[model samples]
Target: MLRLILIGLLLLVIFPVLASAAKVMSADNSHWSTARRDSTGIAPDPKTTPEAVVQVYAARAFNWRGIFGVHSWIAVKPEKAESFTRYEVEGWGVSSGRESVRIGSYRPPDAYWFGNYPELLVDIRGAEAAALIPQIAAAANSYPYRDRYTIWPGPNSNSFVAHVARNVPGLRLDLPPTAIGKDYRTDGIFGVAPSNTGLQLSLFGLAGVTLALEEGVEVNLLGLTVGIDILTPAIKLPGIGRIGFPQGPS
Candidate 1:
């Protein structure tokens, strides 16, 4: 039984990562500065729409990291706003005394992360978006790891997005399994799932189990996740992400 379990894990988890790593290695963008960061044009045009909007996006992380996980961010545009504000965390400038939490409109709301295209995880508009914007901002501002970042068992980018999702349950954000740090618990080992529909118990984000209405059942081993999303009827793999029905805004 144990051997079968190990084989299943190897097929479901390790193989996907190895396959993704092959593609990452062959990519032309050899350096971060040269990677594509253009907008994917999926976001609503704030200048023309004029409605409050909130969106969450995730993309494969830069370079080799893309093989294991992704970086995610939240973007908001209040009613009548001309631009969007994006909030995310990164480890890049932290060592040089820069805060890990970044808030600004320096880039388009749906800009690619390095050379990787982004996937929208949540979309809320108009009054609903307006109501949730402030709460999301507050959650981002209060992120406990604003000055720290750990790529593995982390308070990294995924952790930031998960934090916001937990605080603003209305978003119904369903972070993918490749979002390695989404289960990190800054306050304690036990807490509500990021989707806020169920409960989770994570040991510093490394090992955990999440059972939620939106998430279904997930198991995290060393920051890699494997599970089944009963809500969407999908299988979540560690490095390859979701497979089955398409998940998007309802």
Candidate 2:
């Protein structure tokens, strides 16, 4: 009986230490994976796979009165790193498709229009793509929706700020929780004729609690400005999309 008790006590002490050691080892492994292998923790090289290049675009118009207005786009690439490794393409076009998506009681069919007319072109390397996708998705779902809402807001702004900081944990900064009472809406659209052509990224669905980090890169383009943000880490979006750290790199 005494021997049994001794062994029990030993396990009680050793088990926690063993568990802690395992956690530490895991953390170290995760760190190495991200730093050395890949920039966004998704795929080391997105351009390496031709399929990695994804194009997202949409367009919509509404009519309120006699006036007919149109908004469209060319393309904008979503990125999580400084450069794209896997994909490069120079394409230009605009999208215009009218639909009745009511914003208020008065549903305009053609007069009211919102879309992007992008002509500038960008190259998305593999590392950059891994980091860019999630931020764009998050921005698409973010709060304080303007005429339309976006996650990264395309490759335009120098910085991407989340109104609800909880949505992106990889940013590695503190963000206050969003207020409870506010009305928010979002729409993603693209025009038919583009002034410039660059890589364009759009979200198809609300993302899960995926692991990611926000990275900003300075950019200059002829007759246009190119700003890029990369999202990092391979993460699974659990029930609540708000950001939090789990064990391991992602």
Candidate 3:
């Protein structure tokens, strides 16, 4: 499985440019220039922080990509720690041989993605987070594709968090449908859902299906996934994300 993933990554590296462009794009590249990436004050400031905490966030990727896909990351603060340590894979510098999978790379556990606000997918605080912080870190450190990055069918940001969730199912993280690259994996195509309650099968991240108590049923076609979250009673469309209920709470 590792060999297969390496081959795919090699293909992406060799083919720096695709023959055809992605069907849809984000609003514009300028969003990254003008949009804010600061802390949203959702996670407690680690300076006077008291207990451990773990949070997972997903937001529309910058630009037209935001209209169809999302980026995801994990943040964990050990008990009595001063600040939160974030883990995510980014594609910004891989072409230059820089490591894309970053641990504690950036902060503000709930920071905005470009100009988009994130939806907290999982929250475990206090004692629970204390217990899980080590395991989460281990998984982040253990990610094999530390230097690989592919915008499509990827080891992109979504895939990184999904890998951690698979490694630590206790998080029970359910990435949104718009997390287009979550299906990509370093292991193999077949694995248990991160929730540990369902089955998932993929084909080099391009095509697959997932069914779980938390994720419901999803079908991936050329990296574009469509599914329904029966538990939430929502529909997961190709580009619109979930429709039916306002996510998170007031």
Candidate 4:
């Protein structure tokens, strides 16, 4: 068993390092201030659609951070609303007393994260979206980490999204393995998975195991996660995320 665990740990470190090296070679070296933040046309226009919509998005984090993980956020558009509201936790300005939880319609709902294109993780529309919008808003507002931000382990952007996902199970959000802070548990070491479909035991997000219908089996080590998705047939890696099949709401 010890040999097996050692082998697993070696694989976890080696694979993510290889993936990160590849990402570095092909990375966009643009400065964050000048990086593209335009919309990718993935979101339905609020004026034209007029239907309630809820979406979860993840994008490679800016600069070198992109090589390791992604930043996740949630956006919502209510029926007949002319704009979408986005909820995300950002580390910027936290030391200056600004809250980490940012809620507004400042940018395009589907805008790129710096230079990284955003991938839609979950999409819900019509009546279902309308019903869940309030709950999502409440979850965002009630997030305990609004005043705190930690890039590794717990209570960062991914943690914020995970909290919202756990509260709104209808989302069935399957955050990718690259969402590094997703396993951070605010309530305790034991809690429901972000998908709310199974259980997870995490030690303040540093290390843990997650098993769920949506997330499959993920082992978190030192804030990095490696796993296999049985339901979707994918191998979840640290830096490169899932390989084999795409995951999203049906």
After superposing candidate 3, which stretches have Cα over 4 Å from the reference?
A: 1-31, 246-250
Candidate 1 Cα errors over 4 Å, as ranges: none
What tens digits encode model 4's per-residue C-alpha lDDT throughout 84-165? 9999999999988999999999999999999889999999999999999999999888899877998887689999999999
Q: Which stretches of candidate 2 lie over 4 Å from their true place?
A: 1-51, 54-120, 146-250
Total clashing pairs for each candidate: 0, 59, 6, 0
lDDT of 3: 0.78
Worst-scoring 10-residue span by lDDT in model 3: 12-21
Per-candidate TM equals 0.97, 0.20, 0.84, 0.96
Q: What RMSD does each model have against the real structure? A: 1.2, 22.3, 8.2, 1.5
- List model 1 lDDT by residue over 51-86, tens digit each: 999999999998888889999999999999999999
lDDT of each: 0.90, 0.24, 0.78, 0.90
The digit string of per-residue lDDT tens for model 3 on 41-92 reads: 7877777778888988998788766655789998888887777888898898
> Candidate 4, 33: how far from true, in Å?
0.8
TM-score of 3: 0.84
lDDT of 2 by residue, 1-250 (tens): 9999888545443443354345334432322223221121232233344432222211111121001111221112234322332211101111232221111212111111222121112223345544654553544344332223222222211111222222333323211111001001122322110111111122321111111233122121111112223332222111111133321122
Candidate 2: residue 219 Cα off by (Å): 20
Note the residue pairs that clash in candidate 1.
none
